[model samples]
Target: MASPTLTLHQYQTAASETDRTRTTKPTRFLLLGLFGEAGTLLDEVKKKQRDSGSYVGYEANVVEELGDVLWYLAVIASRMKLALSAIARPPEQSISSYATADNEIRFSDLQQQAHLPFAAPTSNFEITLLRLVAAIGALANAQQQSLPEGDEWGPYLREIFHILIQTANEAGVTLENAANENLTKIFDRWPEERHFPPLFDEASDIAEEKLPRHLEVEIYERTVARGPGIEKLYVLQRCSGILIGDRVTDNIMEPDDYRFHDVFHYSYAAVLGWSPVLRALFRLKRKSTPKIDEGEDGARAILIEEGVSTFIFAYAKQLNFFEGQHEGDLSFTLLKRVREFVSGYEPKHCPLWLWEKAILDGYAAFRFLQRHRKGRLILDLNNRSLSIKAI
Candidate 1:
């Protein structure tokens, strides 16, 4: 029938004198890189504590470092070209931010929903780290001339949920469920499980073998270039293991420091002869998480939540929306070429232009990049759904 105004769903183009603000992506990367430095600093501080055996004396610096980490984050957004206008409403106004104050409050409400054990303040280093990271995304929102009288979490929180859900689905796991269950049990909001899922045994094998199929790839590559928002959470959930209460923390303190086994519960099926730790990590739990990262609510919130009124962004290497390949026989070996990029890599080195197009126009978003295709590419089902303009 009629052509659509926009090809897919994602952040709209910027338009305005205020929208002219630059230095957003750089801010985020700055904070991310700074955090890496902070982690190193934390490491050194810990080593000093161990050597001097006087960590209690330096307890205050620990807190100071946390604030420094967040401050760096706040400023990084400034460097990445993030601006108040971007978060409110654009200058020329391409997309309608689509966020509401009601949604902004959810970030705070999630913490109050149920009881969580040993829960730290929303300002805790871990929680604050994510919020600050997510907040840097304030610029991703459509900028506006004026803001309402009272506003809390800011607009960036909405994106965390959006990206969390999608990536969780693609990676094929229930870290979210574990996230929910842990909060429920620890907070006493819900009863505890009588038994723990068995220890995963197949993660290593799957790591070496390959991942499975996903449907959203077509839509994602078509839409975003990973400019901002939930894409942050999506990347986090994929690479690092997420945890909430003691259950989650305890899980991560396993044999070594591997939480993927606990969250995905994949390794449970590795069976002595079947696979390795990496492969087994992908087997235990194949169930997907919700559509967004609601912080403490974890997975149950997803099942109970309603329509998606939030906003998000993503990044992709290519956009071949028209994957005419056999439905069951898609994916490729190159899919494995991006473990670091897809999971845990974050947007440190990813391009916003690519993420924006992937989340909006799908594979077709790679029109400019496609000109460099050395030759037609081949399709192989061994890998997950990936690549653009396959031969």
Candidate 2:
């Protein structure tokens, strides 16, 4: 006579039952849902601000929307087999402390001048979504996991959950209802596991038809640029360091210097590819032994790699790439953006010009983050923008 109470794990399993009958990829479906739901949440927040001239009147409404975002985040974590506790765990050290003195001073000044509690721009929600997506892409690369087929969504999901949890906590939203209600709604929608028509077929069709034309390398090159403080950019073959494309700020380096830097970048990429953390996270089976090449850089560099290609950014000096006080922390956000670009890249018709454009896009993304000191870069096909969050 009594109704059943669902545990988080049980809720995840029940809600995902319809996943088995669907033809769409799990990650892709989840991504679409995640983005759509996030967009909806952002839309609601924007509407409240525009209609009422402030968000104070719509606090409850915004909290409800945040719950919706959290629902999608929980489902994503469930599909990835990640525990909510793990996702909600904070890093031992925060990344903001890793900033250079100048950066720290600048951030401190911004914090002091901020009026809003979160100090984020009006479009904070949208930018947060972009950052989350970029983080997913980066985690995939660091773990050597590919999109759609990759089973290692745990780390990515954990990161998303962290963001959602932080946002909800800051807003004073209680998530218990949101989680339960979402599962109940999903179970009702799928009910008995009957097949329903695909919801995104037309969207997919349009994307397939237009993606190539819109994402042409030439078009990207024309639109994307190295914003500022970008000394050099290189697109090289993942292991070999054979140059695929490059944009230099100054004259070319000596042949020996170039080779040394190639080797250094390659080594870093290899470590990322073969990292134990990545391996364990994705459950990757080793296919071949990793090869190491000897070589060298004075300037600080960050390497973001895909299956076949790598994008290397060379900065003028050593900037802390990690988030927290730990110097070892890597810039997961930047890595994610690069991976997102690389994964969506069409290689068949790609030329040097296209590679140049892609590299420029990477530069632009890095420059934006560096300038704002707090924000995520979003690249929507040919359109590129920075989502600013107050430090």
Candidate 3:
């Protein structure tokens, strides 16, 4: 079965639905976003040029950036109260006639077009990209100059869209692919439907292999001797009166109380319902399925979770451990990096807001532990929460 064709108007309509800035400075916010995305696109291209031979994932990067660019263009058109197909009219065609023409930018069409040779050389493609950027800049210039909106505006935007289409063609990218990928990325960040995603081990036949819905982990500090006249504080955790993972210290010359960072793993399990490290610690590896046991519940997955916890701790250290930030306050760049860290893992299915909640809630519990040095970390996957109880 074929995926339904995505026409320009359909894309613009869908993209507009996800536009959070529709009410708040819609034009200005979108214009600024357009420029920022354009700069990002240019930067990706710059990296490809600079690292020509060694640059891996160049096409993927281009597709992502191009998707972003297309999204901004679609929403910007929506803001101007014009259909995307209206702005996509060819240079020689009259806008009125093209407006009603078939606006389909289908995957099959892209596949057919992708085989055709580029009309220009690689250098020309680069120049065309510059022209596209300049065209975007011209939109800002017109807005700043208080240019009147009228008949010429349609043709003006068409030219920019023309350049954009040309650039995508020369880069061997399809606008349909760009649009679809952009929708995926955006919806992954700000999903239209909000609900609890299914737990990673929800279907496990082994009851003990499932993450505990509610866990009360007692974490305390113990003093250990490193050398004569030297003592270091190590953190240890226990659940159901049985000692779990090894004792940990700050692992740095300066004591930042990172020994308490296990709270982050618990946060992942509680909020995202996926934590390989915690699963390993609690003997919850889904061994019933050999592939699941090795691939999803194995050492590499545990390392990825641990790496995410430590990486986020470092990021939070710079922000005072997200002291005053709200649930949605984590920067998109940080979330994007975290997503990249666990790109192939099960947790990658979780959305941005959930990641934010896990981080903030984990730090909330961590901050409490850092101050008190010991506490009961209460994780309720049923409630999707992490709470601290003074010990």
Candidate 4:
């Protein structure tokens, strides 16, 4: 007797049925199962290599783990409205066809494949599987000298597919989508194929235009003012962490404001290290840009930075004009005026009170500008103008 071949749709249905008793959080549940099973598979491989100095007799265990990984992958595909067959099949016009005469796959070929709007595996699952294939190829090349010649790539391919499928399921991403998004981003960073450099390096001489733009520009016809609920505003030097200037409503101050200001700066910097995909998904824009941080207590913090040198941190009791468009405009205006004031007035000669007064006057000017119903107020510094176009 021989075992019957299972179709892709049938396998997906079976996998979904097996996990029907679990929680409704399919994404989280599938991810945990995929990684947990993969970890077990890797552990078995490691144990065999450590004890026997090779993975000779553990082939059956590896196959079983790979099957387990595939099962989870099928379930995830079902959740994402994708069929396993769709991911398994190669495109009609394959990317490999465009390879150089020597069969060399250049970065340009990868970019061209990514930009093909009609390409198959446009979803995340398909793209991920392709990456797994690449990994398997690399592994085979490295082990060519040690491994047997006959069917040498078979086990390696299976093992990679198992890992790739499970990992993609866990991340709630399809390989195709991830690859396409990444390729687009890479193209943006390196428009020319010849300009693509090594993946990892410490060289900082890359052209500024080659970098991804994180700066956001907001233009408004009218400017508003921070109302009664406005709390504390602090101007801090980013690199030195010095409190350059501050203004408090009612002349009242909270001791925690200093700590909050410091933590906010560090937190913003930390978030910049996150992947572009995660950053875009979560709407985590760059630091120093105007953004609102809301707390559970109905309070909000309006944060803005001036280039990389200074940051304006403001806290408000409510999410009103203080934490909205007005704050963004005012913060930039105040930062420009304050930076100019500090540059000319010798800190050693000027009293601390005078510096504080300068900041207060800037705040006062921002408030006055908000009162104008119709007019343009332009502040030209160093030939750059922050203009209120119209109201």
Where model 2 places Cα greater than 4 Å from the true spot, the runs are 1-7, 18-26, 53-68, 74-85, 93-152, 192-391
Position 154, candidate 3: lDDT:
56
Q: Which candidate number would show the highest TM-score if scored against the true structure?
A: 3
Cα distance off (Å), candidate 3, residue 33: 2.6
What's the lDDT of the predicted structure labeled candidate 4? 0.35
Q: Which candidate is the best by lDDT?
A: 3
**Overall local distance difference test of candidate 1:** 0.27
Of candidate 4, the 10-residue stretch with the lowest lDDT total is: 292-301
Each model's lDDT? 0.27, 0.37, 0.79, 0.35
- What would the per-residue lDDT of candidate 3 be over residues 276-307, giving only the tens digit for each residue? 88888888888888998899889999889889
Ordered list by TM-score, greatest first: 3, 2, 4, 1
RMSD of each: 24.9, 23.5, 3.6, 23.2
**Candidate 2 or 3, higher lDDT?**
3
Kindly list the per-residue Cα lDDT of model 2 for residues 114-174, writing each as its tens digit.
Answer: 2234322245555664665566456545435454422345556657655664454444443
- Residue clash pairs of candidate 3: none
Q: CA shift at 326, candidate 4, in angstroms?
A: 60
Ranking by lDDT: 3, 2, 4, 1
Shift in Å, residue 184, candidate 3: 0.9
